[model samples]
Target: MAAIELRNIVKVFSDKRRGRDLLTLDNINLDIEANDFVCLLGPSGCGKSTLLNIIAGFEQATSGRTLVGGKQVERPGSDRGVVFQQPTLMPWLTAIDNIAFHLKLKGVGKAERHHRAMEFIDLVGLRGFEHHHPSEMSGGMNQRVGIARALLMNPSVILMDEPFAALDAQTKLEMQEELVAIWQKRRCTIVFVTHSVDEALVLGNKIVVMTKRPGRIREAVNFDLPRPRDITSPEFNDAKRHILALIREESTRLAQAS
Candidate 1:
């Protein structure tokens, strides 16, 4: 059974200044399988993030339906965890506390919170810095905290909106590797939104490419390239070329229409 199902999902934003309704997404339908690493990839303004938000229940669809775990999503819940581009952590709290904050909010005991958070801290390779505050950590470290926090929820689905977009190239690469490792080990469904073609290729087993504004799925490419993917391999380059062509064609089509 599919972990997430989007049936004819559409999103429209009111453009008060323009006195019109701008269609952001148009009839998006997709089924993400359980334990799938699916990347919603497209150019900027393609509404990939909006689609992810709808799935996460942060935003409602203007029309159609979104289902997670065979149930309709009406509001955000613990079944889904979201990681934004920024590490939205509590600056005053220590790493372990930040990670266990959600449990604390639910009235979990302090001993249990630390015990559970410690597992994720170790999972994200932050075992030594559990007491460090956000101010004392680097961007990569804080992002790790964000990821660990989300993971601690043990959600059925994880939604990430360009979580590594702000990191340095080296740090981004490291985080990507760590994330893939975590996903492999945990076997949870993940829907990640990214504008970078290479980032999608590196992180997703299934790449759902979206079109320009009034977004539609251009194609859903299934890439089973082996882990520790060689970026320069012939198979990798071949796949990249195909995806680039699809995006280029979309751009050209839009240009001609304009």
Candidate 2:
């Protein structure tokens, strides 16, 4: 069975000011295999983030079902970990403390919590900066802390909503490389949402392209490109060309409708 399943899902939002209901997602279905890195890629208005939110149990679908690890996802649970666009770390706590806060909530002792979090701190390359607070760290560093926090949960699935979207180009590339390495080592299912084609191609083995508002799955392209992918290779360029064509077609269709 698939590690994650979205069966005929639909999401609608009531636009109070417009006095109408907006259908954001329509009859979407997807199956993600274990340890697969899937990227939900689309334009800004696409429901990619909404889909991630549904999987995270942060939003309810208007219809259909969501199952993760053979269980219905009715609410948020420790079985799934999430990393949002922003770090959202606690200002007062140090990086290590923030990473192990979940353990603290479950009554773990400070010594044990720190010890456990230390592994993830090293995993994310924040070894020497473990004691730094959010304010003391750069955006990328805080994001690493957020990722470590999520990893420490040992969840079956990790949901990321453009976690590196706000970083500088160089920082973003570094984080992407590190994320792919961590995903490979950890061997956990990851569903990442992003608007960047390059970002999606870089990180995901399976790229699920989504259409604009009233979102539908355009295609789920299986990349299977070798790890430490050569972005400049002909194969990579070919894949990029195909994806760009799909996006252009979608944009043209939308233009005609308007």
Q: Top lDDT: which candidate number?
A: 2
- Position 74, candidate 1: lDDT: 93
lDDT per residue, candidate 2, 1-258, as tens digits?
Answer: 999999999999999998999999999999999999999999997899899999999999999999999999999989899999998999999999999999999999999999999999999999999999999999999999999999999999999999999999999999999999999999999999999999999999999999998899999999999989999999888999999999999989999999
lDDT of each: 0.95, 0.96
Sequence-dependent TM-score of model 1: 0.99
Candidate 1: list runs displaced more than 4 Å.
none
Candidate 2 has an lDDT of: 0.96
Model 2 spans with C-alpha error above 4 angstroms: none
